[model samples]
Target: MTQPDFSQRLHGIIPPVVTPLKPDFTVDESALRRVIRHLLDSGVHGLFLLGSTSEVVFMDAPARREVLRIAVDEVAGRVPLLAGVIDPTTDRVIAHARDALAAGVDGLVVTAPFYTRTSQAEIAEHFRAIRVAVDLPIMAYDIPVCVNVKLERSTLKQLRREGLIEGLKDSSGDDTNFRLLARECAEDPDFRLFTGSELMVDTAFLVGAHGCVPGLGNVDPAAYVALYDAAMREDWTEARRLQERLIRVFNIVFQGTPRTSAGASGVGGFKTALKLLGIIEHHHMHRPNLPLNDEETVRVAEILRAEGLLPAQERKLVPGV
Candidate 1:
């Protein structure tokens, strides 16, 4: 397959797709394909697999491999497939990277080493080692909340200067650092900068971000695609309007339901919303993470109905009725 021109094709709304699972905790392949089709048909720019939204941390090796394999096959080179190699160390991440590449992912998304405190120097070395191990394009995933180590501006600038990474997905939620990175990398046409913050996509665009990898995009991709288009057209008013609506949809991420704890709510909310929309078969969370119970599922349906995502008829069949 021909490589996508990352400089152009990589920019826009790319959803970090959820891993659809069966009750037995195995990947539900057909449902996974259906979700992919929904996103693609909704005009998403790309597909990101096995990221935080994908429950990568909870998936075993075989499950992760299957997710990547199915995503690559289902995507079929229509859009770039970015597979996450988020592990606790260099070697483990490299192993995932190798598998992702073998499964035909166009690039790899890697985060800083977790489960141990790491220095900026160590993080830089971690990315460097991965670059040496894999020939695929690399995008630094700077989600400090999950990874613990923020990819410092100086470190990223140095890596960019050395051509060690082709892109960055900043989920750090630190706008100051994100703007600094954007300004420093502005001149490089190939250096893509993506924000994973659903709430701040419009802000990211104004400050030179190329696109977004919003987890919320998994639930309502067309909204994000519209926002990106508006931003690209420099229509701030339209972009802001779309973003505000999207923020409303994003509220489902933290429904404050009793069935879901705050820690698990985001993923649980996404999976439940997908199931309610009929985009996937089930909303089963990966092991150790609880799925949204019946009450929470009904709450998700109501939110979808409020957002015009669900038909009125379906909305009437509320949970516990």
Candidate 2:
């Protein structure tokens, strides 16, 4: 089979579209479609569904597919849609990959197998197995915080060289390390490198990283799109300004900490902001992962207000909401 090439379209602000939920914690397709519409309307470059922002690990197989199905249908190729086939083992990821392929995703975002540590070689083979079972463009998702293993720079380069993965989503939160990798691959324009550093989008683009997968983009996609636009124009000052403002907006993720899991706080704050913006109906999170309380929801709104995302004294939907 001829391998697909997605490196070109995968660049820019590809926010991990969060899985909007119901009071029952089921996937809310209607709200999800609305979220997709909102993102496209904001001129986002791409949509990453069933990602960490979508609570992929916490969802069942059916729910994961449902989110992918909704995203693929709603996006309809307007912007590239990348699906996360994340799981604990190669076979599990392959199963998710098959479902993602069947759902018609433009590409797949995979991680090293987690919960059972393996060597770098084993990780390479994990990605190889998925590509063999399901032919499609793949992006390595390097999120060591969740997976407990870093997809080393050397390993990733080898994968790209072998054409096993066409791009990378570096959520390792180590921009210094990523900086070197980005510089090394500066000549390979097709090997897309997107940083998940919610706070340093300007630095990412400044260092030759191709794009961003900011979780905060769920709350403010247009801001990120603007940041990317600025960086592309080489307007470092504007890019820095946008990134600095975004740093304040990122405070929402902290509102739920100490009271909830880091995952819950980050994702819940996003869901709450979406709810406040009227993009989604509810901010409900999956079980064992508590949703933000009324107090935290109010604080999220306050952050949005401070960031100019909402009217300072009023509570009304934003332009895109």
Candidate 3:
């Protein structure tokens, strides 16, 4: 495949979309479409399918392809679509990349190989091999919390310099390291850098992040977009207000912690919040992961109400919660 010219910088509030599910654990097509439409209608710059927030690791190849197909159909290219070709090995990721290409995604978000330990050099080669196979622009997902190995700044720089990746999704929680990289790559205007931290988007923008991929974006996309707009206008005070409001909204993710695993807590909270906000029908999560209970659901509602996301007229409470 001839490499497409990725000259256009993918900047702005691109959300990592949530995969809404039926109680039977099947993809709820209507709910999913509603969620996609919600994000797009809110003027989100782009949509990221199959990210950690999307529960990509819980899905098989065919399910992932189906989700991408639905997203492509729903979007129809109104904005750029970055597909998460996340898998355990290089060849596996390449396979997903081919599917994403066939599905007509604008870019690929990849990560260091998980479930197997590899050195920084091997990790570098992993990304290189994928780039060798796929022509789509790539974004290195630096999420050490889940993958166990950090995509060190040096390896990321090497990938960027060698043209293996066009951007980064920094979820490693290392602000200093992220700042250093944002400084090092300051000259490359096309190298889009995004922060996965929903709470620190204001600070990340201060350090020159091109955009954000917040999980909370699935719950409240407009606020993220508004925060981005405020930052672009250099309105730090408004940006800080919006960011703090989002931080409070983020409290929903903890409503189910300890009882639920970390992944379930975060994703389930978003799903539950979406359900309460009347965007999705059910808050069901992927199998082997528990959904938020009624008590937790009530707490999520309280957080939404506190954030003013839940209004009296539009209140839709889950039965018995």
Candidate 4:
């Protein structure tokens, strides 16, 4: 398996893959491999495991390790593999980072410490410590919503200047901050700036973003790949058209509304859609995270049908129907 050249920049669509689970809540290796194959066939640029979409915060160490190992083996170096080292402290994150690197991942994706409030200086030290402890490339995961700490522009610039991080996956949803960081980082040809926003991929690209890590890419990777290609070709019209279509399909994330929480809605939606596409066998999320109910499953099926994702003959076939 040939690894990606970390010396070069990483760009294009990388899906934060959902971790498929069995009825007993164990990692479903077969279904996971199927999902990986489906994404690869769809022409995704890379695989991101143990991300928020993967429910890493809720999963234990064993489950996370299993997911990373399976992804590395299935991917076989066809593209770069980024495994999330999401923890509340530096030591714990370093532990996961070591495990992921040993499992053959090409890079590590880390977020600011959660569960405990951290100052900007402490956050910088967190990343600096990880970079010192690990030998692989590190990509900063800026998810302020979950981590409760924003990676400020000055901090990011400092990190980049000091070579503490090679890239960023900004899911902060702050357009102004994103653009500022993108503008400042534009001078470094090797600094990868990836938007975790599926809805704003075109806007991000237009402003010099290098790539995207969309959760929706797990469902329709070809669409994202097409969008990235169009953007790369500088065809804003075509890119916008494709992005709008994807946004419509992204509505499935809201299907659990008025009943389930947003997190449950998103995970259940993506897993159910995968099952409908016959890419995975089960749509079960991990324990404590609710799956879509009977009625919600029907709604998901309808959404897929309207989006032309379900086969005409199987339009009437709902899960457990």
Candidate 5:
């Protein structure tokens, strides 16, 4: 399984596709298929399943396997599918990586260990181990807020030099960090870099990022597609105008929530907004954190409606009616 030639095709918007669960918390296969179809039709460049937005943190092994199978089968090469392998232990993470690859994922989106501090050597070892185990393109998920380990410039360049990793997802929300990483990897045209922050889409492109995997892209896929097009076309005025609208919605979703749990709410917001758009069955969320309360849901509805992301006709279809 040679790695895909991502050097040419990796640049674009790839949403971390969320998992749709039934009322009993089982994977909603039909809903999952429908969401992917909707996203692809809506114009996301690729589909990345089982990533953080899919609550990989809370999903069990069997559930993860099922998701990989369903995504691979349904997508069937219509677009690229990268399964998210987010485990705290390197050995177990390697197992998941091999399994996901066998299921026909186009690439591997992996993050370093979390909860405990791991040295840079450990981080490098974790990624190198996976690279050796699977022959797919490895996109390092450098999200320190969740993984507790950040892939700095030197480490990424080291991995690139060794041919052990191909690209990185810079979720650190630091423009300077991405700038440094971009500069360090500038010489290696094959080493792709993506920004995980939606607000910084323009800045990331300006700094030589390959693309973005933004949470908001789940709700505003067409808008994001347009932004990417404008940027690629060098139309800064159009891209900035669209990004401002996205940033407004982002600020609302992130407000009054702890940083760790902020992404959880954003995932919920995407599902909620999806329901409002009449694109899904329900705005269902996995347990332990119930779907947003009525007031919060109403507020999210109001903000999206105001932004024109949600129309009045569709807002009536949300759950908790």
Candidate 6:
């Protein structure tokens, strides 16, 4: 096969799509394709599967490959598809990377291992090895909150110097790091940098970052697309306004859910909001994570309605318009 035209291959609203599961907790291939088509129809630039938002960490190897195949097939050249290569072990990550490439994915997004914190040097070595093992373009995921190792500016530079990594998705939610990266890799235009934080979409655009890979885009690809379009047109006001609305939706879905003694995480909230929007069959969460309660669901609906995202009296129309 020929080399992928990376310049033409990346950029814009790449949502880390949610992995829809059936009641039996098996991968729902049909629903997965539906979601991908929905995002593309809504105008996302690319599709991302098995990323952090996809609950990839909980998936085994077979399940991972199946999702990748589903993504590659469903996308069907209408848009590029990328898959997560985040594994706690280096060998597994290498294997997964090879598999993703062999499956004909456009690129790979690899997260630093979270189990047992590895030193910066060790982390650097890990990425370098995988870069050599796979021929696909790699985007390093720097979500320090989950993965203990933060992708240091110096380490990123070193990896670039060694020709091991091509891009980065910074979830550190730090503006300083973004500005530093823009200056450091200023010459390498193909060295893409994406903001993983949904809230920082505007800021990242301002700092010369290529685009975003937000989880929220799984539900609201329109908002992110509008934001990116606004940025390209230099419409800062409209861009910020759209971004704020997305932040509001995120806040409601993430916080309205009640917490258990173990403390609440927002994966359930995200899925619940999707269910409310009729995007998924049910707000089915994988094992060990609970679904949203009735109260949270009502609140999420209220927020969506107030935001005018769902049908209201004004936007409402008779059947078939």
Q: Which one wins by lDDT: 1 or 5?
A: 1
Predicted candidate 6 versus true structure: per-residue lDDT over 202-293, tens digit per residue: 98898788889888787788889999999998899999999888888776546533463121335666666676677777666677676666
Better of 1 and 6 by TM-score: 1
Worst ten in a row by lDDT for model 3: 1-10
Residue range with the least summed lDDT across 10 consecutive positions in model 2: 312-321
Off by over 4 Å in 1: 1-4, 256-259, 316-321
Per-residue alpha-carbon lDDT of candidate 4 for residues 19-56, written as tens digits (9 for 90 to 100): 99888888999999999999999999888899999999
lDDT of 6 at 22: 88
Q: After superposition, how far is residue 184 of candidate 2 from its true place, in Å?
A: 1.2
TM-scores for all predictions = 0.95, 0.96, 0.96, 0.96, 0.94, 0.92
lDDT of 3 by residue, 226-264 (tens): 999999999999999999999989999998889999879
Instruction: Write model 5 residue lDDT over 1-321, tens digit each, in one string.
Output: 355555567778999887888888888888888888888888888888888888888898899999989888888887778888888888888888888978988888888777778988888888888888877888888888787667777887788888887788888877887898888778877788888888989878877887889878888888888988998998989989989989888754653255326666778777776666666666667776556556666777788878887666544533462
Evaluated at residue 80, the lDDT of candidate 1 is 88
Give the C-alpha miss distance for residue 86 in model 3, angstroms.
1.0
Total clashing pairs for each candidate: 0, 0, 0, 0, 0, 0
- Candidate 5 clash figure, as a count: 0
Candidate that beats the other on TM-score, 4 or 6, i.e. the better one: 4
TM-score of 2: 0.96
RMSD of each: 1.9, 2.9, 1.7, 1.8, 2.1, 4.0
* lDDT assessment of candidate 5: 0.80
